[model samples]
Target: IQMLPMLVVVCLIPTVLSHAIPTGDKQQLQWISKTEALHTLETAVRNDKINCVVCSTIVQGIRQLIEEEQVEEEIDEFLNKACVTLDLAAPYICEALINEYAVEIYFVLERVIFTPDELCGIFVD
Candidate 1:
């Protein structure tokens, strides 16, 4: 009777409100930026609180920097050090770094900022 109509309205309210929620991709993209990504990675490394999902997102965003071949000295330095920071157990996050950096590994190497040892260390061991 009256209770049935109340239950129906409650169910409809949830359906209507669900559309207002942001999707995961939207939230993840909105939360990431280069400087923020770098900070998140740095903090995670320092704190030893590496979350695979967050690290993966940061690494994915970092790929954009590498792809455009951004040549600023600071950008170069960040990538060199950031690459060394991935010591977590998630192979995919490490793989994301490798796949993205593989494209410009030599370019990064030629800069003389990161040694071959450091670059290899990220993936090999």
Candidate 2:
């Protein structure tokens, strides 16, 4: 078929390089600097190629800030809006979550900056 060559070129590259390079290399998460990370967010928000690994790396950096309490105001809001909303709902032909979905829950506690003095509890009286 005429289309056979085109498909071969696309498929063959990754298939060959993948075998040559260690699988761990592909899995390794590279740390990007703060400015670069922000740029990634801007690009990822619109781009089709953004995946869980990319999102996770950025989220981890933000989480680190939340842990350190270094930048209370700026980091918390960003964490809630961005990381917490990640959708790991699955892939085509298999609608299952491969990525563990916990950014939002963790962000709620860690990035709140401050909470109310009064805690509410439900009591069946």
Candidate 3:
């Protein structure tokens, strides 16, 4: 009876090890698009939920989805969608806003090393 438990344990080791080991390629992380980020921001703005906590969460989420090299393009795409979806201003005004602030936005997003919380703290408060 003493060897029976040991035998059972030895028999199960291979089965557990096979399942634990990887058999194929590693999976990649899926990221959201600019449109989704815009939609989320718009919803937060419309619902009066644009506080530091909310902003930090949004920024962190976007940061994870986008790479440093893609910051400028993502900002442009996000702002364009926001202008149309939120209807905050006319097309010219939107264009001007993008022209005026896109570089600053890109600088903050790509060049600055601030964490999402720190970034939102500067802007939100």
Candidate 4:
């Protein structure tokens, strides 16, 4: 549905920023908890310098989390909070979108298995 693109972007934000952040910033990130790290990356992606490296990192991170079976509940909680915090849509709409598309999103993420660089290349280039 129309909300799918938004979902993809939300999911990919952390991965992309992981690549875009400077080495010093990346080092700083290593010490943070995963949730804090994700928030930091989310903040970074709001900047204007997004590129292929960022995109690749984002895709790779997402795939890794999914593969590790650590994504479902966290993704749900993260997206729900992000939806409200970012104010990308109305609360009801955001909830509806998450409820409707989470399964399909997970299915695609699990099945595709494209290399981070490859997927990022497609989007970033």
| Best lDDT among the predictions, by candidate number | 4
Candidate 3 structure lDDT = 0.47
lDDT of 1 by residue, 26-61 (tens): 347343334454455456556755444443343333
Whole-model lDDT, model 4: 0.57
Instruction: State candidate 3's TM-score.
Output: 0.55
**Model 3 agreement with the true structure over 6-123: per-residue lDDT tens digits:** 2111112112111121122238545444445455556665675556655555555444334434445545655555554455456666656666665665456556688767876765
TM-score for each candidate, following the candidate numbering? 0.34, 0.34, 0.55, 0.58
Indicate the TM-score of model 1: 0.34
Q: Considering every candidate listed, which one attains the maximal TM-score?
A: 4
Q: Where's the lowest-lDDT run of ten residues in candidate 3? A: 10-19
Report the number of clashing residue pairs per model: 0, 0, 0, 3
The 0-to-1 C-alpha lDDT of every candidate, in the order given, reads 0.37, 0.31, 0.47, 0.57
* Model 1 segments more than 4 A misplaced: 1-35, 72-74, 80-125
Residue 118 accuracy (lDDT) in model 3 = 84
Stronger candidate by TM-score (2 vs 3): 3
Candidate scoring better on TM-score of 1 and 3: 3
lDDT ranking, high to low: 4, 3, 1, 2
User: Which runs in model 4 stand beyond 4 Å of their true positions?
Assistant: 1-40, 44-51
User: Model 4 reaches what TM-score against the true structure?
Assistant: 0.58
Query: Which stretches of candidate 3 lie above 4 Å from their native place?
Result: 1-40, 65-68, 71-75
Model 3: lDDT of residue 42: 60
Shift in Å, residue 21, candidate 3: 29
